[model samples]
Target: MGEIAGGIATAGVAVWLIALSACDIRSRRLPNTLTLPGAAVILVVAAGTGHGLAAVAGAAALFGVYLTVHLIAPAALGAGDVKLALGLGALTGVYGADVWVLAALGASLTTGVLALCRRLRGVRSTVPHGPSMCLAAGLVVGLSATV
Candidate 1:
């Protein structure tokens, strides 16, 4: 039963990430509707699975970091990215701090590379970070599962 529930939760996270990534790529926006509820659902599931502390810590850490970035340079990191971090952090946090750190690094590096590519192409518009975030988290989750 627990395994079944965990699988369902994982699926939910995957779907949520994919949906948000698509939306962000298309409109450069992450809806509060998806971000808020997705975080809540993951947190609740984490608590139920005895990983509440890690999940909360991860969510808070990411939220704080992103929020500070958004505050310092609103043009650099948008509010949507900050909000999206809550759920991604919780998802990786449930696995462990190591996984969370890996996901964070992956997201940061992927975004940086993407931005550099865009700059090289002379497209001066903003690069959507949400897809990078989602991809990193999803990849980390998949890799952690295999390990």
Candidate 2:
């Protein structure tokens, strides 16, 4: 991808991710409104731009990872999250499998630290994972585009 195209793609995906994060933060639910359309947009762009097959593999790979956890503890992980992961996996997958690994590891570290903090504070309420996911997505896309 050229400089302008990569920048534009990253920007578009970032916007989507940020909007979804806001919704998730507010409602603790990732409505299909944003995520479904967002996934379509990412996959379409990725396919048209020559990242098609990798994007599919990426989405499947990440979806499976989350599915495993979801199966283990359905209550702890919501379906919305798994759906969001599918979209995000496709997004990160455009770059490569390594990008998905980076995003997952980075997001996991962020979530773990925040969750630990909340536990220490005696705040038992569930923390929304979407924001961390978005943060990781943004970081991966931005970093990959630059490199």
Candidate 3:
């Protein structure tokens, strides 16, 4: 499981997720300032620790998938969300495919519930999905530890 089993990677991801969530919620933007550098750090650490190829491939694959979705419906997700997915993919990859699927499911459920609640409140505007991503990241990381 790489250093995520050691907890350092998970801790780093936790902090990064919090920052990303806060930025997205406050400004409805996930700045390149955060996601780019964060992705770099994750890649470097993963490579140095011998999970390089898997991490890079996972990030690329997830980024591509999300990018495709963004291309199809640009209004549904911004570039920032795609970038955030890259980082999350790498983090999840270190754990495994099961963890990745679980995290994605968690994110989807969180987002759906949040969206439903906002709709019930008569909010028709976009709901920032960054926090839901963070929630999923935390879930995957914590759950992976136990499993």
Candidate 4:
């Protein structure tokens, strides 16, 4: 039963991420409607599972790190990226730190590659980050399964 519930939750998250990616790509903005509720759901589920404090802390930490980066290099990242990280962090907190790290690494690497490809093509680096967020979410799910 737990496994089934987890699978359903994972699938739901994936669908949510895909929608967010589409919106971000089309409009360059992530709607609060998607991110806020998603974070709330993760927090509620994590708390119900006895991982409340850790999950909250992880989410805050993720936000804080991103906030710092945003402050330091505002041009390198966007507000949507920070919000996306918060959602991913909350989900990762439900799994574990390892999954969180894997997700972050996956997102960063994917973004870097895309940026490089765009640069090589002599195109301006205006890559939307939603796809990277989706990749991170997928990586988190895969890593959680391994654990």
After superposition, candidate 1 runs with Cα above 4 Å error: none
**Number of backbone collisions per candidate, in order?**
0, 0, 0, 0
Q: What tens-digit string does per-residue lDDT give for candidate 1 at 20-136?
A: 999999999999999999999989988987889999999999999899999999999989999999998998998899999999999999999998999999988878999999999
The TM-score, computed over Cα atoms with residue i paired to residue i, of candidate 2 is: 0.92
Predicted candidate 2 versus true structure: per-residue lDDT over 32-128, tens digit per residue: 8887888888888889988888888888888898889889998777778888888899988988878889998888788888899999999988778
Q: Candidate 3 residues 30-112, lDDT tens each?
A: 99998988988888888887988878877887788789989999988889989998888887776777877787778878888
Question: Across residues 1-147, which tens digit of lDDT does each residue of candidate 4 receive?
Answer: 299997897788888888888988889888889888888888888888898887787788778877788889887778878887777788776677877777767777888899899999999958877678677867777666776
By TM-score, the best candidate is: 1
Candidate 4 lDDT trough over 10 residues, lowest sum: 137-146
* Local lDDT at 37 for model 3: 88
lDDT of 3 at 3: 57
As a whole number from 0 to 100, the lDDT of residue 21 in candidate 2 is 88
lDDT of 4 at 14: 82
User: Which pairs clash inside model 1?
Assistant: none
- Superior candidate under lDDT, 2 versus 3: 2
What's the TM-score of each model vs. the native?
0.95, 0.92, 0.89, 0.89
lDDT of 2: 0.85
